[model samples]
Structure formats: C-alpha cells, structure tokens
Target: MHGPLNPESPVAAKVFPSPNHGERKEGRRPDMVILHYTGMASESEALQWLCNPVSQVSAHYFVFEDGRVLQLVPEARRAWHAGRSWWNGEDDTNSASIGIEIANAGHPGGLPPFPDAQIESVIALTKDIATRWRVPAERVLAHSDVAPGRKVDPGEKFPWEVLHEAGVGHWVKPASIQDGRFFSRGDRGMPVEALQAMFAMYGYGIKISGVFDEDTEKVVAAFQRHFRPERIDGVADASTIITLRDLIAKRPAPTAS
Candidate 1:
C-alpha cells in the first residue's frame, strides 16, 4: 500500500504508514476500540516493528511518550492487531475494532507509569476515533480483554478511570479490597457458572460451565487488569466480584432495533 500522508484523526500529528493491513473483513465497520502497549524498551523500536511487514502486526495509531500521535494505518482498514481474540461472541476482533498502540515499557519494564503527556495524547486520539466511529464506551478495551492469557498489553497500570472520566471508556470505582468469600481455580459449582455467565454478559469470552478452570482464572485476571488494577491475582475475591457486578449494572444499554 502507498503511504498515507494525511491522518484519519485530527489528533494524529502525521501518518507513518504500515503495510500490514487489509480491508475490514466482510465490510464490517469498526464498533470497538482496543488499546495496547508496544511493550518494548525503546519507543523507536516499537514504532518500527509495527511498520515492519515481517513483524506481522500493526495498529491504526501509535502514541509516543512525548504525546505525539501517528496514524500507522487508515481507520477504514483492518490492522493486524488483536489477533486470535474474541469479544461479545465475535472472534474476528480486528475486523470490528480500531487499535491504538501506546508506547510503554509495559510489564517487562516493571510496568512503568504512563507519562502524563502520553496519556493525554491517548485520551485525545481515542476520543477522536471513537467519536467518529460512534463506538460505545463499553467497547473500549485493553488487549487482554479480548485475548486473555495470550496477551496482556497496556497492562494493569494503565489508567482506565482517567479515560472513563474523559468519556472514552467504561469504568467504575473498584470495590474496596478486603477479606471475604472468594472463588479460585479448582472450585466448581453453580456459583462458578454464575460468575462465568456474568463475565460473558460483560463481553468477556468465557464459557458458562460450572468449573472455575484455567480459562476462567485468565479471564478474571484480564477483568482485574482493566477494572480493578489494585490486585490481579486471578482469584475472584469479594472485591473483584462486586466490581464485576457494578460494571455489568453500569454497562451501556443496547441500541434500539
């Protein structure tokens, strides 16, 4: 593909075209926003990798640590992000989501804090993309949300609440952490089934089986990473359960038919 000199979002300072993209599958329009961290020590290296066709990955936009935004692929095209992921019963996430890669050292670099400037840029870019696409607030998600266990970018340290406050994503004040009844792997019963159902209802790709299996643990961890960052032990403590319940209750209503 030829380089795109003009950016799809005004928030983007310029375009840094990447060849790793294709037409949105089945002509599906983007309805979700997926955020990721480049997870490399050097921001330049991360940017280059996204643009490298050999890497087989790319995002619609990339945000630098200094708050500069670059459009890597056009919003109308499907970038090679969110691979092998699922959400709200949709397996082809890339076809229906716009992806943003925020440059950060991520978990490998001890999960460093996102700079204030960088976060501001992320908020501005996300608002632009979501607004233009009419994407729902609840659909703004971390990479882990769609591909739990397989990927965890823009990790727990990412400030989801800040984005929510800026009207960019769904969020709720996490329930306080405390000792109480909790669920963990190896536990199995109707309660486990209920927990799985709640997660599925919230768009998590979890099966409603009565077993708290490894997949359940991973999904719970992903939920914690996005919602309750204070702790992400994979165990469903009272705090996690309550937080999940609150999120579901606050989810935006479906559009009228």
Candidate 2:
C-alpha cells in the first residue's frame, strides 16, 4: 500500500504499485524469476485484478502487449503470485522469486501471439532482473513449470527461445518428435522410476515411485510445455527424454553465494 513508488529496473516505464505484497519470509533473496500471462481478454482489467486487494494476487512487474513495463511491487518484497508453487525443493516460490505477469489472452482466448515489441521488452526486463539478482538461467521459469497441473499461463506460444537468444533464460534445440518407446499413465517399472528421478533431479516436483502416475504425467506435460514444446501430450517420448538430457548436460553451473 505504499504511495507512488519508484521503478527498480531501468526497463520499467513507471511504477503502478499494488497493495498485494508482503515482506519475503526468512528475509529471502530472490534467486529465480517466474513468468506468467494475465489470461484475461482485456489487459487493463487483468492489471486491475492483480492490483485489487480482494484478488490477493500480484506480480513484481507487468508487461503490456505493446511492451510497456510497469512495476507493480518492489523487487525486495514478495508478491502474492506463485501460490502453492514449488521448484528445486523450495515450496515458497513467492519468497524465492520475482514474478512478471505478461499481458496475453492465453489458452482461453486461443493463445494469442506475443508481439515482437512485447517480447523484446520482456527480454530487457528479465535480463535486468536476472543480472541484478544473479538468477540462474534455468531458474527463469514459467508459472506452469512450478505449479504444473494447477496453472498453465504464459503458454507454449510465448517465445522462450527468443528470450534465450537474448541471454535471458535457458534453451536448447528440442529433439525432433519421432515414433519410439514411450511411457504413459499407468506404466510401471525401473525405467519409469528412472524417468521420474531425472525429472526430480532437474527440479521438477515428481515422486520416483517406479510408476507413471497422474502426477508424473502432469510433470511430463509441464516439462514439455517449457522444454520440448513441439508437443505436450504428457507422454514421455524419445524426443522428450533426449531433449531433457541435453538440457541437463547444458545447464549452467550453480552460482556462488
């Protein structure tokens, strides 16, 4: 509820402070950046919803379709976004990350394209935040990445590769989709356990129970949505697994504290 705030990053045009944030728990410093899409048809309404106290949701920044950037919450504070989300064993993502909500129609509006100007602005803003916070490349994540089944904003149509090309986030060429051995729901075995283990090792919240259950499927789909976005059927095909291995191999070294 702070009156007219100053923008923290040079990329933001102005401050549009929201009342929906709090101090980061345990005095946590952000090491991650979570991207989301405001899935409403009207950008103004979406922004208002985030600022409304009744909604209990807000992000650190808001990016409009024309690429205008607005700082809704201060970077040091914890925005109310990323509810019930987890990443790399951290359940309180709101405290551990900065959230950016991009204005887009998302799946509900047939997945509209993000304008080039918008994408460029997102790149600049993300790079600024990541640089200031020393956020790892892989830690620049989608809302769906951390909350899988519960959310899917900033959908596949969002150009992650574009951001990666600008040195903002992680990206590798996805493997070609082809027919091969695949694992699906209800499958069980050591291979399934191994698959789950790999996902968990890569920071997905999956259980290695030697069975491909519903949760595993959701995680797989989430992985596909972020990594191998060419197809997101929740089936772990050869392309999906190989792409994951490539990503793991190319993941940047952990940043020193």
Candidate 3:
C-alpha cells in the first residue's frame, strides 16, 4: 500500500506505497498529468526502485505491462516523479501534475513497443485522472515535454494515437512527412523566432532567441516525439510546422470566446 495506502483511482486495485514523495509544493492541486515509461526490464524492479527512498522518485500511478494498475502515491499528494521539470511558466511540475509511469523496457532496450494491453490501461487510468482533476486534454503530457533536455521516456513508440482514439488525450492526424522548408540548429531569423514562440506558447520551455540553438532543437524534437512521431530528427520541417499549427487551431476555445 502507499504510505497512507489511499486509493485515488477507482480503476487501480490498490496502493503500493512509495516513500519517495512529499507534500505538494505550496498546496498545489494538480492541473496537469505527466505520463512516463519506467524504462526498466521488469515492472518489479521498477516498482522497487520507485519506492526505494534512495531513488527519490514516485508517481501517482504505475501501469504494468500486463495491464494491471497500481497507485504508488496518493493522488492528493505530490509525487516525486517529475524532477526538475517545467511547463508553460511552472517550474515545479511535480506539484501541479499527476505522474504515471508505465512499465517498459525503454529506448535503451531498443525502444520496445508498448504492449497493447499496457496502453489500454494507461488510457483508462489517464482518463480517470484527467476527469477527476479537470486536466485539460492538452495538458495531459509526456515526461519529455516538461523536461525536454533530460528525458525521452514514454518515447515515440508509446502509441499516442491509440490513446487519442480512446478519448484520453489530445492528438491529431500528423501532417504528411515530406521534403520541405525546415529549420535546424544554426539556422536563424524571424521564422526561427516564430517557431520558438509557438513552441513556448504551447508550453515547451523554448526561448524565442531567433537562433536555432540546441535547446530549441531538443524542444522541437520533443514536440515531434509527442505530436508527430513519424519523424524526430530535431529539425522543424514543414510537416512538423504544419502539425503544430493544426494542434493550435484545434485547441479548445475559452468560455468568453
């Protein structure tokens, strides 16, 4: 059971108490959800590490490869999973988000595809959390999204489209990949600045410096990984640009607007 063994999700069978959590920073209520992959060969090891105090990491939920769901931290408490992360202007994302780590042999294990059963579990769990927390469909994000330079978990093969089809998170038909105008590191100008602004407006921690620096490249790659998984070469190509524009266009309108 989680330290308090409180079950936050109706779909989760039980709490698996992880010691690696603390008070939500400044009494923050989660407004976002961050998904991650354990990146371990086995769920047992990953679970053990997450609860191990030395690991200093935990998530609100953990989904096994076989589809079993477990809560590792109380939903009302801050889980330590998102470390040194940012989204929009919020730096301590852990406090403002619920983290879920899916068990998988990650990119180091050759980027193994997430099992269909596991993905199903993720969709259900995410739907429950997002509904309960009133998290925006677009605010359901990848770990790499909040920590662009440091993380790539729940990588490109995580089947975001499948989740989208399940009515869990935001997604779109990725634009067709083709040769076209593109921006890569070292490119510069108003167009590049505009690209950075778009990414930043969409919550990626990119700077509108006008120079296509490494940070911008990583953020672009992160965007590609989550939004347009067809290609992730750190270049802002036409397909990527078009895809970003589409997502922005489709975002929900404000109540007054």
Candidate 4:
C-alpha cells in the first residue's frame, strides 16, 4: 500500500485504499467474483465502515448508488472481505475472488432496492473484471452463496437477472412457485440425498446425509437466494430442485482435448 492510488479496474476512477487487507495466499490470482451489498442504513456510512481498520473488512471495488465506482484494494491483494466463508471446498474466498460491494441497504435495513444507476455500474465493473480474469459466469457468486447460514447480504431483493441481462453473472428463469411433492425439515431418504448431492455439486456446502436437516435447509435457502429468488423459505420444493438441475445443465463444459 504505497505511492499514488492505482485503480485495479478501468471503470474505477480513483482508489480509496483500505488498510485491512493482506497479500493473497501464495500469490493466488482471482478466478471468481463475489458480490455483496452494504447492508447499512446509508451508503456513506457503509463505505466508511469498510475502510475502517476496526471493521477488518474491505472489498476490491465499491459501486455507489450514483454509479460512482471506487477501488479500495488492488486486485492482486487479498482484501479482508469474505471472512469465514467456504465455496467449492475452498475457504479463502478473499484470496480467490474479486469482491464487489454494491451500495444498498440489505436485510438489516429491510432490503431496500438497489438504484438502477448503481446496478448498471456494478454490471459494467463486473463484466470488465470477469473478462480480464476469465471468470466463468457461474463463478460470479453472491455473498450468501459462499457463506450459507453465516451471511446473507445482497439478499433476494437484489436484481441478479438484471446483472445477467447485462452479461455479468450466471442466471436463469426461476422455476415457477407451485405446490408439489416437496421435501422439508422432517423428510429423509434417497430423494433427500439426491437433493444434497445436487446442491453440493453446485458449490453449496451441504452434506448428502439422506436426512433433511437444518443445515440442508440453510443451504437450500442460500441456493434460492442466489439462483431462484422467487422464494427463499429453505424448503427443498420441486421448484428448487428443477432450478438447481437447470443451472447445472446450463453450466459450461470443460475444454478437453
């Protein structure tokens, strides 16, 4: 953290460096993008808190409501975001992903809608970073996606489809909400195991225990929050299953010879 400010992204006009960051573990280069919402009452307050040393947290970029973008950490450093998070068996999400904190009052503030100006900026920034990093669409993840049961910022209210429309992240039409033979907290058997396997395959931290438990429900809710925002009640309903399967199907194939 030395000389003049350097913007890791072309979209960022300036840098407001946060001290609460470290070198990426073993020089790990980013291959993922993690999106978050400020979740506080005011954008200014959220930005200040992120830069505060006591907060021990910062993202690589912050997208303000008026479409202003600020780079708080260099892409080569491990920003102190993504604390205690896990994804696809990797625990150091901060070191593996470019984190973007979007300005919006999240669940703590009743999940206010993100302004279009801010979302557009996010889309622009994400597309640029994703392209340069060769990040797969499916690797652009929500905060909830990496830390189920521990974090839920950038909640269901966030317009993921809008970002997808702008070619930023992976998205699909949510399975229609309907009544069907669904699994719940009390169910168990081959179906439950199958559900857990599918979720785990999709990078969710779930166990194929053949028993529908609270952890399974939380992971299901996290999956819904990121994939199927139409409903997020932690129930493994048919809609959730179909959505998960569809997402898996749409995932890109490996380029093997």
lDDT of 1 by residue, 189-246 (tens): 9999999999999999999999999999999999999999899999999999999999
Error in Å for residue 205 of model 3: 0.5
Candidate 2, TM-score vs. the true structure?
Answer: 0.98
Model 1 segments beyond 4 Å from truth?
1-4
Return whichever of 1 and 3 wins on TM-score.
1
Query: How close to the true structure is residue 100 of candidate 3, measured as C-alpha lDDT?
Result: 96
Collision pairs in model 3: 1-17, 2-17
- Between candidates 2 and 4, which one is better according to TM-score? 2
Instruction: Provide backbone clash counts, one per model.
Output: 0, 0, 2, 0
Q: What are the TM-scores, per candidate, against the unseen true structure?
A: 0.97, 0.98, 0.96, 0.96
Tell me the deviation in Å of residue 177 in model 4: 1.5
Residue lDDT tens for model 3, 178-228? 987899989999999999999988888988899999999999999999999
| Model number with the top TM-score | 2
The global C-alpha lDDT for each of the candidates, from Candidate 1 onward, is 0.94, 0.94, 0.89, 0.89
Candidate 4 lDDT by residue in tens digits, 146-253: 999888978998899998888877788888989888999989999899999999898888878999999998999999998888788999888899999999998877
> Candidate 2 on 137-245: residue-level lDDT in tens?
9999999999998998789888899899999888899999998899999999999999999999899999889999999999999999988888999999999999989
Would you give me the overall lDDT of model 2? 0.94
Query: For candidate 1, what is the lDDT?
Result: 0.94
Candidate 3 wrongly placed segments (more than 4 Å): 1-6, 254-257
